[model samples]
Target: MTDKKMNFEVSKYDSEIAYLSFPAHPGKGKKGIVMKQKELSSLIEGYKGPEVYLDFDENGELIGMEILL
Candidate 1:
């Protein structure tokens, strides 16, 4: 098996919400996921930023998160 790097872009929908977008490519298509303000806060125990980092598996699939906010 080989590790494939995943790509995602972060954007804030509001002061209380944000989302991640994985652009479409060849065999894959566009996809997105949202994180609520409450969820974000709990994740980082006070996460507040305009950007965040995401983690994925060898298959290039989102596993949860590692927010940088």
Candidate 2:
């Protein structure tokens, strides 16, 4: 994925996740997931600086999410 600010639901919330456009239907919308306030803060805190973007790859094993600085 590109380093664009995509939407994702934190797994901690209600045990459900929604992606923008979503995996079920790729490129179907302008924005897939809508981030909640807490999730947005957590993501921002990981940056520890100015707001930017992050990108990651799909690990062959388990699904992975990171707050990498």
User: Which candidate should be chosen as best, given lDDT against the real structure?
Assistant: 1
Misplaced by over 4 Å in model 1 are 1-3, 8-27, 30-39, 51-69
lDDT of 1 by residue, 1-69 (tens): 334444444434534334343332222332543222223444686656744545454456544443444
Candidate 1 similarity to native, TM-score: 0.26
Top candidate on TM-score is 1
What TM-score do all the candidates reach, one by one? 0.26, 0.18
Please give the RMSD to the true structure for each candidate, in Å: 7.6, 11.5
Task: Please identify model 2 stretches exceeding 4 Å from their true place.
Answer: 1-41, 44-48, 60-69
Q: Write the per-residue lDDT of candidate 2 for residues 1-69, one digit (tens) a residue.
A: 644344455445544433332232223333523232123345555545432222222332212232312
lDDT for residue 65 in candidate 2, whole number 0-100:
33
lDDT of each: 0.42, 0.34
